[model samples]
Target: MTTVAHTPPSGTRHTVADDIAGVCEAARTHRAYGEEHSTLHPQVWEALRSSPLPRAALPKHCGGLEWGAPHIVEAVRVVAAADPSAGWAAAIHAPAGAFLARLDPPLAKELCPPSETAVAAPVIGGSSVPAGTTAPAGDRMRLQGRWPLVTSAPQLTLAALAARTEEGTRWWLVPGTELRVEDDWDAVGLRGSASHSVSCDTLVPAGHSVCLTDPARIDGALYRFPLYGLMAACIAAVAEATAERALEAFAALAQTARPRHATGSLAHLPAAQEHYAAASARLSAASAFMREAAGQAWHDAVRGQVENAARARLRAAGAHLAATSAEVCQSVFEAAGAAGLYRSSPLEGCWRDAAVASRHALVAAHGRRLAGAQMLTGSAGGHL
Candidate 1:
């Protein structure tokens, strides 16, 4: 499964999709190293650099593929099945690109060059930004805030910061050099994700900013999507892939790793068999649910039918997928018995990753309630 990226001759263009398999293979082979570094393996990062996957959701004029939402979700789900950290890291690109699409063309081009990569961290709960008394100077604004859970901060060239101004909430693109990343990403799972807090105290040109929910400057179906729903789909993709990996790993382990005092392999055990079947069925259903929701959302957006109720349905689908995937991972872990408990076992990693990812704000328990409320009340004005 080992694959390495190669250099194309000058003038030969390369895209993220070109490196997808190599990245997945590298991530799969170097999962332990990624966990140790609390970030993607260097090789995986390099592979992603040559990939077009990151900007898949952006308009073609911006060097993106303008992929449908369903396509992006499934691609992310497949990647996550290899390495959740890679999956999680890659999934952020769509939303990041979606935001980038709203920026003025020249600025978007300058900030998001074809070779450049960026990640985002929204200001959540409390504000860490210092209050400024002066208005932004022309096209430049100074920022001073700490954003937590910024994935892949070490590998990115830019970061999208969700901030507050006197006018309202907005998003700004800040160069990586202007921000400080703290090594505080230690967590129980998905340790490979360098999801540390980043502090910024620098000026960014006004061209690099946009209203958070403004109609995208680029006309396309992807730009029509609500940021919340896109984010939910991204996180759900990770959960779905991790669950799939756990089930596959457990099935493989059962073929050879017999239970204590068992006559045959664990695969023959009634309990293991039941667990495998049940978990597989559950994961399949969740995968279908997630894809369907994304597909429907994409369909509506393409036809200009995107509404709060539809967005709510998509969010609920993402949450359900996350919750269901976590359950499947747990089932697989329990079925593996003691063999699944060790750090050496992939099952342990899968379970940990699924558990942690399920808690992400995009797919948390509150999302389910919000979706229900939106559907019942026919309004989008609620917790996001």
Candidate 2:
């Protein structure tokens, strides 16, 4: 398998922002192909694999960037703005590296060696919800199950799948090559994410599994951040960025599109102007709230003082962002009139992508309910 070099040449430093820019450029260059083909563009995947964005949440000891939550959120935002599909993939796969910290040091180091030539930390993809069953087999576990909605399934080197054991639910780290990838994803939006179903009926060593509720062996601020919270924030960023792109596309269309029986172009219509202004304001407010929540959570993580209230706020902000962004996209699509109905229109694609993103488990209405329950009763039923 080919691997992307994580280290730059001698004396040439590559910042996280630079890597993010490169990924964004690649996403723009191949967005159309990915959208049409219903799979991630190879070049876009390569660019993302080589970039530090995927390693932003990894531990520094594992040669990861270990970026703060706010930075990670911003990186997803920029990439999503360039192409919503690429951004969705990034949001799903970026936090995967942090899971390695839960494994024993020896196995973690072996899987992701701390060397310049080692493959960029493997993109781990799988569902957290348990859909499989596991049984004890000597020093290993006999695993059999199928997980759905696995983003970038074909590209993943490892899968972090959850399975129900005799004891309880446990996460297993299985090699992607050992799993059967079913090309079953045919979603209307995020077509390029390759969120297919993966099934495996094989034995996995005991060392490859971890109970996520346990403390991570390798301690760090990034690892300290709540996994669900981070996932929600990243998902929210993609939704907000996609909405921003939709608004931009609408602006461009308004400048030239003349509605059927209108006095002038769409831009001159009072109703169109009102819709654009309202959508823009909604997006701006949602973006600010997301950033503020992410920043505060990161601040608490750095000090090793993260509170339940902070996590709840961050999750709430993410849910709010997803809902608001989807609303903004809907408003823009409606205001674009017949122009947005065409497949060639970027606004149309944005609307579709936002509609799908808003349905993600982390950013959906359930997330808000979880946050509200936590805030109101100081208990989320241990869901988070």
Candidate 3:
């Protein structure tokens, strides 16, 4: 019953930079879709399905392209410019191929055939941010839990989750049909992303879940790979892209449309030029650092860096760049003022998405603490 898709040729490889422009151009032309496209836009889904990188993360054993984090970053940057919510979904789903790759061969084949994109949704309710209890019932596991902030819940066909049992937090997988997505993600930003809560009060067969590791040993190369950190880094990298586009938009505006307070032309003003210069540098620096960190962590992973050192670098780089990206957006927004806050302005949504999504518990201050503490105590950081 599993249907896997085949891989595209390397000659057809689409890098991050290429994808960034693609998403940006898409967003540029289809900005209105952000408000009404998730359910309505079949073309959007088709455009995403065509991306080579999302399928690249899977291992060669399963017929996946199996590209590393650099490709991952590129794909993310591509979608980042288009829509953060889309990028965020890609951040979770694309990289999960590695986790999927680790599954028992039968389990991997059963759930994901070959070449097909399998969606895994993590719900955010119960004690488990993405918690659900699965007991045997018929051909499936009886699922019971609520997952709030389930990013891209509507679009997903799989849910990778944890449950509270007699033992502890256990992971399970629920098919998309078994779950119900709540109409609750009416937030200030990323509205296009249906990151709603999912009601998990149904049956999900055991065949759906992949038990990758014990909680104690979950600290393997997979866990150490900095999933959360990468998520944050992707968010930040996208924010940087948003800032870049906003600047371009603003530059276009300044060239023709005079500022209300400025005399004569807007671009000629010293203060405006300074603002543009400063924001640009911040974005450039943050992006360069993020790319470096992603590259380093990936190289280290391939080279067999494990548990501590590899993760520490990933966390340090992810957290630092993410934080910097947020700051750069903030600085640019200041220059943009009320016009940037217009409901029609992409900056508004990008800003809100950047702030709201980056606040994820994994990417927050505690993550930074773990990075710093590990750096001091000589323990591998929790990042890996």
Candidate 4:
């Protein structure tokens, strides 16, 4: 099997921003192809794989920068500002190695040898029931089940499957080839995310399965906070990026759009100015709120403190930002008038991306409710 490679083909210093810009520049010309193929262009994928963008949150020993949630969120925002699909992919795939960092030493060594770079795709939402029947076969178990919404499934080297069994829920690390892609991720936005259904009927070694340990037990600062809270913040960052793009696109168009009765451009029109200012204010407020929430979460994590209520509050802030960003995107699109309706316009894509991203379960209505209930009861609300 081919191992995940980390060496960049070019000899140069590359930061997260540089990697994001490269992908954006490449993807900007391939939006039509991405829409048609339902995946990022091959060049864009290659650029992503060759960069250090994937292991941003893993421990230093595991080849990550060991940065906290805020850095990851910022990187995601920069990427999504240019290409929403690539931004979403970065948000999902970058911190994946952190999951393995929580594994036992022996298992972690066997699966992610220090000499190898590993790419793991987390299957977020799927049936809790056993995906496929499992039978003991020598040192391994034969398992079969279908999982959905496996982000970046095509580029993965390993799959982290949360399988339900009579014993309880267990984590299964299966090889990417062992799973078959169903090619059914036909979403209206984030088309290049490679979110597809995967069915597996293969032998997974017993050593590859383990009961998930509590994040608090992990020694890394990245695991100090609740996982969902960090994830929600990153998701909110993407929405913020979408809003920023929409607002910029609208501002550019407004400088030239002239109404029939107006002697000047839309920028001089009272209604247009009001719409632009309102949307800009909304985006700024939401962005500031998300950053503040993420900053608090990171500071607490670095101090090795687990403040559940604060984490819940962060999730709430994230949801609010997501919703607010969506509103900003819609407002900017409306401000674009007929131009926004065209598929060729960036406003249309930004609006679509915001609509889909804001609805992610982490930032959806339920997440807000969970945060609210937790705040009201002074509880952690682990359900999130």
Q: Write the number of the candidate with greater TM-score, choosing between 1 and 3.
A: 1
Ordered list by lDDT, greatest first? 2, 1, 4, 3
Best by lDDT: 2
Q: Which ranges in model 3 have alpha carbons more than 4 Å from their true place?
A: 1-28, 36-40, 115-130, 134-141, 165-168, 203-226, 341-345, 378-383
Over the stretch 280-365, how does candidate 4's per-residue lDDT look in tens digits?
A: 88778777777677777777888977577777778888899999988998887887778678776678888888898998887989
Per-residue lDDT over 1-384 for candidate 1, one digit per residue giving the tens place of the 0 to 100 score: 011223568856543345477768888888788778788788887766556566667656566666666666666766787789888887776456676778778777786555334222221111113232224766677667788878887766667777877767766777777778888999988888788888777887767766655777877787787667887888898988888888888988888887889999999999899989988888788777776777777778899857777788889999998999899989989989988888767898888899989998778877888888888886553343
lDDT computed for candidate 1: 0.74
Residue 105, model 4, lDDT: 59
Clashes of each: 6, 0, 23, 2
Q: Which stretches of candidate 1 lie over 4 Å from their true place?
A: 1-19, 113-139, 261-263, 381-384
lDDT of each: 0.74, 0.82, 0.59, 0.72
Of 2 and 3, the candidate ranking higher by lDDT: 2
Candidate 2 regions with alpha-carbon error over 4 angstroms: 1-16
TM for every model, in the order presented, reads 0.85, 0.93, 0.80, 0.86
- Return the lDDT, model 3, position 333: 66
Residue 334 alpha-carbon offset, candidate 4, angstroms: 1.9
